[model samples]
Target chain A: MDLHVEGVKKVYGDGPTARLALDETSFTVESGQFISIVGPSGCGKSTLLMMMAGLLKPTAGGIRLGSTPISGPPPGVAVVFQDYGRSLFPWMTVGKNLSMAAAADKLPKAEVARRVDEALTAVDLAGTQALYPWQMSGGMQQRVAIARALVVEPTVMLMDEPLAAVDAQTRADLEDLVLALRDRYDMTVAMVTHDIDEAVYVADRVIVLAAHPGRLIADIPVDLGRRDQLTTKAEPEFVKRRAEVFTLVRRPAATSSAGSDAELDGRPSELKA
Target chain B: MPDPSGATSTLTSAPPPPPAGDKAPTTRVPRRKRPFGRRLVSGVSSLWLLVAIAILWQVVATLSPTLYFPPLSKIFVQFGQDWFTGDPSSLFLSQHFFDAALPSLRRLAQGWGLALVVGIPVGILLGRSAVAAAMYFPFIRFWLAEPKSAIIPVAVQIFGIADSMNVFLIFVGTVGLIIVNTADGVAGVDRMTLQTARSLRISPFTLYRRVLVPAAMPGILTGVRVSIGVALILMVISELYATTAGVGYEILLNQQSFKFLQMWSAFLLIGVISVLLNVVLELIEKRVLRWQRREGLSGQ
Candidate 1:
């Protein structure tokens, strides 16, 4: 689905003490595109994602899934939350958890089982049907969460830093798995993360966000060619693009603002305008 | 495959040199098994602690020769002679044990049945609805603290000196606890779980049935166990104060007649029954909450 978030703003608390979490944040994810959002801590990245997922209502402005005008949770959208431990019900086994999503959607029994098996197999956890979530390792548990989302066959997948808790090696492996699944399912995925390298590695386009009333600061296409674990990070272009993105993020707004003001007043170019 | 002896010989003779990063091969002794003597001593010591208490009780009884403080041996002898013999005329069987005990058990069952029927649904409603909780909770708390046994006189006045008065008082005593616990259990379901269910568009009935009830079961069971003890206490107290039959009546009757041994037996019977009830409830709780055991520990 073509997800469009138009001038989305979220304010917490009330009256004079009200704090802006997102300031007129807007973005668009075309159908079947993989987008990653990166930002500093407390940047309202999660708030923005939750708005897009229709989990949290924005204080002002609105979101749309192909002009449907998002209100509450959209029908063809599924979310994979950060805490895998809290996401799945402790009382349920893997099979039961997957089946619950399907059952909620009122899918037929045979179809639910088939989709569950396919989703589990896609995540390389095919034979763990009866295992409870607590019985699995962190990575495996997250895979089960991903499988829960995939079983619904959602058009839009909103992942909130899904691999943040896993070890480095497992995070990389899971990132690859996400990429492979995106290709296989032809899914439109919007992921929020803090890791710059992770944002570049997984996303086709990376949107860098700023904190203190979070707003879009940089939207750069990750043009690193033929991405993989080995070649992706090793490429010279990857290093240059990363440095450029970092520079753009760290640019001093106060000094740059004075220069922009000078240029706006039609000052000569030689005066550091 | 190398033979067992050959493998050992190779291991000893080869003595592979340690790698640059390797530390010295320190021998680790397998944990020594506790000798049978030590194990036996520990086991016997635990038993002795309990036996010592029993002996102390016997010593106290033997020293005091008071009517109220009968020796444990004399009580046991009276219990065997009166209750164990086939003859229905025995004091333990005929007058004290059956005539008094069976009626009390029957009254407890009746009163507890009434409490469960009224308390459970009310508890569930109060738990789920804030408005209901606000309306009923203060009243329940007030009644719980009002010394319900004090109402036995009023109950007798209202229902007359009949089984009805006793059962009514027992219900009044026990029902408040069940209601409060049930409400608490229902309220204790995780907020996120409820949110997930709501996000999934689960119907209200299904949410209650599938998520709320199961989540609150441990709390509900706790309430039930607590109510059982209350029920037992109420049953005996009501019978002792004003009743013709039941175990409590037997105790009161024996005390009046100065049949101290018979009174003691009645108290013993009540204690045994209460413990048995508690044990059965605990077994049931373990079975019902098996899934919760590991989670409860890890959560703590």
Candidate 2:
């Protein structure tokens, strides 16, 4: 099923303190597309992902999966949060954590076990079913989080900077792991990240977002056929896309349509552009 | 994996086949295992201060005993004779153990158990609702701040010298801590975890059972841990207020009769029991939160 974010706008508060978090964001993630959302910190990338996951309500417009407008958490969507350490229940073993995705689906005990096993093994985490998540390294923990998303057998997997809290080496390893997992699961993925190179490295389409009332800026496609952690990064197309996304992120959005000019209002008279 | 695309295994390093012995092949993971006797000795090493204090007390008392400070050896002897003199059928536990210790334990279990069973849910409710928290949190704060002893007279007036009075007093004294900690724990659940649970579409009941409760468990257990000490203190204090047969009452009787040696022995028993209670609670917490522990990865 395809996901559509239709003219969605989010406002934080009302009256004087009202801040526009997102502005009439619209996009349709084609089925099986690997879309990477990249921006500077305040771009509302996480907010957009949360809304897509149906964990947050858009103040205006709506998000739809297939034809259904999502009022609650959507049916065939799963999420991997950035903070892998805190995202998992510190009380459950790796097996129990993955089985949780199947809990409400009412799968049989054996089916739940099968899915859990399959998901872990899919992420190269086979035989770790009995271990606790925290006992593993940060890299391994993130793999379990990814495996958790896989267990749901979701049509769409939304990751909120899932590689942010890991070491550089682990991040590189995980970036490839994610690419492979996407191919293996055949699930559409929308990963929100700030790292420009990573955004271009793994995504088929890199959606550049601008902050100060975050809105979509550009949707650049990466036509790189096959990718490697070493060679693909040095490819001429990859370097150009990285620089393009980097410039868009740093250029400061030209438009802020939510009509809250606090970013400029707080500036000195001469500094106002 | 059953997936035919298992060809992607080259993308990430393969997880070593599960180890047959102790450690995994992952980056040198720390293991807490040691030789049995050494492990025991290391664990016991932490108790050295207590043993040293006991020895000091004994040496001081035997050499130059004071009227107020009775000899430690005599107190130990009294503790043995009083607690271990029951018939064979009673497993050599004396009348004092049956009447005093057993009653104390029963009241402790009931009151403390009621506090936890009732308090955890109430705390979660308080945590979930801003209106409820606003209405009750101040009152709870006032109660917690006020010495629990101040409430004993109120308890006495209602239950009046019955076990209910002691139970009531213990419940009142300790329930506040449990409630406060549980509420804080629930409130302190990681925002990401809650978001993940929401995205997973966990049912309301399952969310509470699987995500909310487990996330708040460390806090709940902290409250339980703190309440253990509070419960023990309250149990003794409640007994002192009024009770016919209890460990606290035994202390009172011995003190009144000037059998300071017996009083001291009863005092030591409370210390022993307090330590035992802490150990038991810790074991339960460790088992419930085995995920938080790394050393004991043996059993499921």
Candidate 3:
């Protein structure tokens, strides 16, 4: 189903020193689309995602999944947080974690077992179900987090920098895992990331957000053709697109008027849109 | 597809052909077993250390018999002859074990049960509500430092020289520890977990049963462990003061009659019971925290 975030604004504190974390920000993800949001640190990408996940209520505006208004976390949305160690229960085995989510949804025992097997195999973690989270390496723990989310068969998966804690090589492997799973499940995903290459590599469309009173500054499509870790990064178009995103991200307020659509760094706003 | 055993194998294995490939289903291999010799060495090492300590104690007692030391051999002989003869008339088994040890165990159960029943809910309330914590915690803290054993006279005055006084003393001594631990455990649950549960739309009852309890379990277990020791101490102290039966009273009776051997034996019994209790608790802790060990190595 299409997810619509409608003019959601979030304010922290009150009066004088009050900060606007999100200012009338809005976006949409068509069904079965991969959308990545990239911005400078502290630009409220996480806050926006949390609002959409129904984890946090927006001070103003709202989010909707098709016809249903998201008063709180939507029924079929699963979140993969960065700290896998904290997100999954330390007392449960990897298999139990998946089963718990399935059981929570009141799935039958047979269905839970089938989904558990499918999720573990999908993440290349089939045999390690009996292993505890701490027994695995950092990358493996994160995969289990992904597996847990997948077991729920969420329609819209919200991943907040899920690969930020892994080694460089492992990060690339997990990125490919995401792509493979996306194709297999036909799932809609909204991932918040600070990595420019990652945003361009994984996303069908990349949303560039400005810092300080965080707002959507650019919405660019990344048409780098078929993606593989090595081949996609090697493409000249990949490098060009990443450089464009970096430039838009680094644009200072002085260069662009507050209300006008003046182009920054001589690159037309058309490329961004 | 076969499950890789180690990091090296996993890295070398081709990423399993995309999910659609018609590869045979993977089977998991059994984990490698530790070498028998290594397992034997670890098992014997722990027992050897205890044996070494016992031998050293025996050597010291044999060489210098003057002061207050008894040889390990003599102690064991006395223990075996006194308690395990299967003789119904034996002082150790008949009078000491039945009359004294059983009474102490009974008193301990009564007091600790009361403490748990009263302390846990109160602790949970204080832990969850700041106003409740602020109002009650200071008074509780003030009482914790005061010697509950010194109130034996008051207990006797109120409940008389009966099981009631023994139970009262244990409750007074141990309830404080239980309350403090329970409150800390409840308060220690991570804020993020609570937020996650709330966002998941978990019902209030399920939130408490599943999230709050599990999150607070380590702390609660710790409290239970600490209180067990406290309960044992209070059981002995209360019996020593006014009770006519129990291990503590037996120790006092033997001391007064100049039966030093019997007094030492009673003390030994208490020590052995405490150690055994602690070992049982350790096993339970290990079972509960098996998953905890697998969590990423953050500082304890």
Return the top candidate by lDDT.
2
Error of 1 at B175 (Å): 3.6
- Residue B156 CA displacement from its true place in model 1, Å: 2.7
For residues B1-300, write the lDDT of model 3, one tens digit per residue: 344322213332233333332222233323569999999999998799889998998999899884345787787776665445556555436443766688888888889988988887778777888899999999999989988878889999999999999998999888888888888998988876776565445567777777777777787778789999989988998888888998888789988887666777777888888899899989998887666664233221
Model 3 lDDT, full chain set: 0.78
Residue lDDT tens for model 2, B210-269? 888888898999999998898899899988878898899989988899889888888988
lDDT of 1 by residue, B204-300 (tens): 7777776788778887888889999988988988988888988788789889999999888777778878999999999999887765633421232
Cα shift from native, residue B108, model 3 (Å): 1.1
TM per candidate comes to 0.79, 0.87, 0.85
- Least well predicted 10-residue stretch by lDDT in candidate 2 chain A: A264-273
Rate residue A230 of model 3 by lDDT: 58
RMSD of each: 9.7, 4.9, 6.3
Model 2 reaches what TM-score against the true structure?
0.87
Instruction: Write the residue-wise lDDT of candidate 1 on A1-273 in tens digits.
Output: 699988788887766566777767677899988889887776689999989888789988899999899998777788888888777776677888787767668888899999997787667666577766666667777888998888888888889999998878778778877877777667899999887788888887888776654667777887764467877898887787677667655655332222213322111223121
Candidate 3 runs further than 4 Å off: A15-17, A234-237, A253-273, B1-75, B87-95, B196-201, B295-300
| Candidate 2 CAPRI grade | acceptable
Off by over 4 Å in 1: A224-226, A244-273, B1-50, B59-66, B73-103, B113-121, B129-132, B185-188, B295-300
Sort order, DockQ high to low:
2, 3, 1
